[model samples]
Target: MNMKWYEVAKIRMKELDINQEKLAEHLDMTKGAISHWLNARREPSLDDIAKIMKYLGFSEFVVNHDGTISTAGGNENVSNLIPYKPGKEYPVLSSVQAGCWAEAIEAYTLDEISEWLESDAHIQGDAFWLKVEGDSMTAPTGQSVPEGNYVLFDTAKEAMNGSLVIAKLTDSNEATFKKLIIDAGQKYLKGLNPAWPMVPVNGNCKIIGVAVEAKMRFL
Candidate 1:
């Protein structure tokens, strides 16, 4: 038998950057079993072929053209957009602290982020994982932000004057997640709690990224 069914498996595995061994793991199979199909020493059963096609997001119908059979879907015409799923984990590597954060920490990602005003419709930006620290901005928002709310940072966005943001202070080797205040020739980091003082900023405060969203896991 030609046993060309393995061709479909090979194509999907290469296209997705997934290996046969990994695919077998995803399908809860032994490596030796998958090795047999790849080596063509033994043909994959109908059940195995069905599982492979489904995992590749292809329909069950295999089109017949001469001796060549093709899968219904060949990973074409798909939007190729990753659907946003909140609470899903993503890597957190600090671009600033290159040495310290080079090893990307496994962090959970948030699906969507809301503006400071709590309007659900105003959200716009790409999701990034960030670590929040310090107590500088405590006047209005940092209370909920907490000391370590793995923030979902995004700068491709818009906000009001008093909205909270994660900004980097050039002079000091640190970034402050504080409320934004832009005035005539003066920029300051506003604190949420009135008791805390609002620190003045200079041309050094770089808006690295805004704290657009967050993921807090309470154990």
Candidate 2:
């Protein structure tokens, strides 16, 4: 998917070795205004985005009617090189039709990815983002994962008892986010909500990844 204008601006800044302070200076705008736009506290008009793009030295920026933005034609010229920070970026999988992403970590294509999530865990493994579809993981009292949140997971981390994980039953192609439980050497998939029943891990169960972070946004 095409990124929003601010995301493209962030990539441009990184390419040009310019910090937000320098970007504000180049745009002749207050740092606070720039910060607001970056943090999604406010949005810039199309004209403002154009000006920011020009100052970032992009050859051209195409804004679609749907508000997505992309750049073309200009090379990213970095005069000051910063140390490369190796962070794990996970692709957001949108559907089970895309196949089992957890089964083949390196085979995911750009088109299958809905968005990207950068993980701070920095573990020596891959990661992915799963969008919570229902309130099955919402607990009545503590640590509820409400519906419509995003969960970031580490593929290398083992899912222990009581650990929340992304899992799929052997017979099913779809992946699910839920708490994992092991009892008497039998594994089960569990929901935090009291109304949901604990499901046995029938056939073959695949543990994709362990939950590392959960994000919820309101507007």
Candidate with the greatest TM-score versus the true structure: 2
- Per-residue CA lDDT of model 2 for 135-162, tens digit only, reads 7787889978887777777789878999
lDDT of each residue in 57-174, candidate 1, tens digit only: 5554452432234435543322221122223333353422211112223224332332221111112455455655554432364345655556666566664476667666566556
Q: Candidates' lDDT values, in order? A: 0.53, 0.68
Each candidate's TM vs. the true structure? 0.42, 0.52
Model 1 residue 91 CA deviation in Å = 3.3
Clashes of 2: 0
Clashing pairs in 2: none
